[model samples]
Target chain A: MKFSILVSEGPYTHQASDSAYQFAKAVLAKGHEIFRIFFYHDGVNNATRLTTPPQDDRNIVSRWSKLAEEHKLDMVVCVAAAQRRGIVDEGEAKRNGKDATNLAPGFRISGLGQLVEAGIQSDRLVTFGD
Target chain B: MTIKKFMFVNRKAPYGTVYALESLEVVLIAAAFEQDVSLAFLDDGVYQLKKGHSTKGIEMKAFEKTYGALEDYDVTKLYVDEESLAARGLTADDLCIPVETMSRAALGKMIEEQDVVLSF
Candidate 1:
């Protein structure tokens, strides 16, 4: 079955991103397809390359970035939410006149339409949120 | 593209957090997809449709007015949990818009019928 996942909380402060990552991994292990992984609200924080954890702790952002890379996943960060939380890509940074871009690899900023499209395209839409 | 049954499950208060407003924004955008869209209001989410929202003191946009525009978007299926409303001392008349009030079990059946359930 194809599934679309919605992650709605930030890393460290919430377990939503971690749980979503584990679920996505399990889905892939079971040979199911992930239609898309959409980050909304505080969940957009997962796409920022600026996230840094201690040497011992699990690196949440990098984990998502790597999994997305290995699976060729479509990881989308909501543009409105990302802008509100300051998670900028090169294009967004240039358009908004910002000095730097912090969007992590394997994730792209997009509109909420991508989320609706995921819901329409996928067989199931599972949400991980607060 | 095939049309799907999309339901937005709202379980938070309106102004205390950003979920209510952001969820509304998604609903408006989802309307453009021409999918069978519905909204479920339970817990504090029932407060989102309550009448007479005054956010001037808090400096937040009183977005309750936007609910009135939902009909124009062709997204009019709004379901309020009856137990949640009764627990909050509110009734259908207290809401700013017309909605169908159903028991939680009935709502669950409706939710089970959905293709995509997006909780907020």
Candidate 2:
């Protein structure tokens, strides 16, 4: 079965992101296809390439990026949500005369329409929120 | 014409934050577009579905009552997660508006059936 997961919480402050990540991995391990992972609200922070935790600490953004890259998964962070939370990418930052957007590669900045499209296409839609 | 069904997922608490009310407004506004809209209250969102919520203390109108008026807007689909209601010790009878209750698995399947799903 193909499933779309919606992560609507940030990593450090909320369990929603971690739990969703774990669940997504488990879903893949179970041999199911992941239609997509749609990040919105605070979950947009997961796409920040600038996010750095202690070297020993778990870097969830990197974890998500690696997972997407390794599995060739489609991970999308909501563009409006990302911008609202000060997470513009290189083009956006350049256009706005800021430093850079710096969102990770495997994770693209899109919009809620992607979520809607995922909803329409996927066999299942799961959400994790805090 | 495909009356694209939309499930309005409300996941925030009702007090102080704009998400709860803003989510409601979104559902109402979408109903104007004649979309098939449903509401699902999960997590702290179940608080928004409780009965006798008078926003008068905050000098805001009691939009809680407006849940019933969803039928007026052709947004009759209403659902609440049973685990959320159970965690809060609430039953469907305790709410002012009528709603179909389901398990998380069922909710997952239902959300996939919609043409659109918006969360706030």
- Identify the leading candidate in terms of DockQ: 1
Task: After the best TM-score superposition of candidate 1, give how far the Cα of residue A107 lies from its true spot, in angstroms.
Answer: 0.5
How would you encode candidate 1's per-residue C-alpha lDDT over A1-130 as one tens digit per residue? 9999999999999998999999999999999999999999999999989888999999999999999999999999999999999999889999999999999999999999999999988888899998
Q: Cα RMSD (Å) between model 1 and the true structure?
A: 0.8
Show model 1 residue runs off by greater than 4 Å: none
After TM-score superposition, what is the CA distance of residue B78 in candidate 1 from its true location, in Å? 0.8
Residue A8, model 1: Cα distance from true site in angstroms: 0.6
Candidate 2 residue lDDT tens string, A1-130: 9899998788889999999999999999999999999887778888888888998889999999899988999998877677778878776787678875678879888756677667667777788885
Q: Which candidate is the best by lDDT?
A: 1
- In model 1, the Cα lDDT at residue B32 comes to 89
Question: Model 2: how far is A65 from its true place, Å?
Answer: 0.8
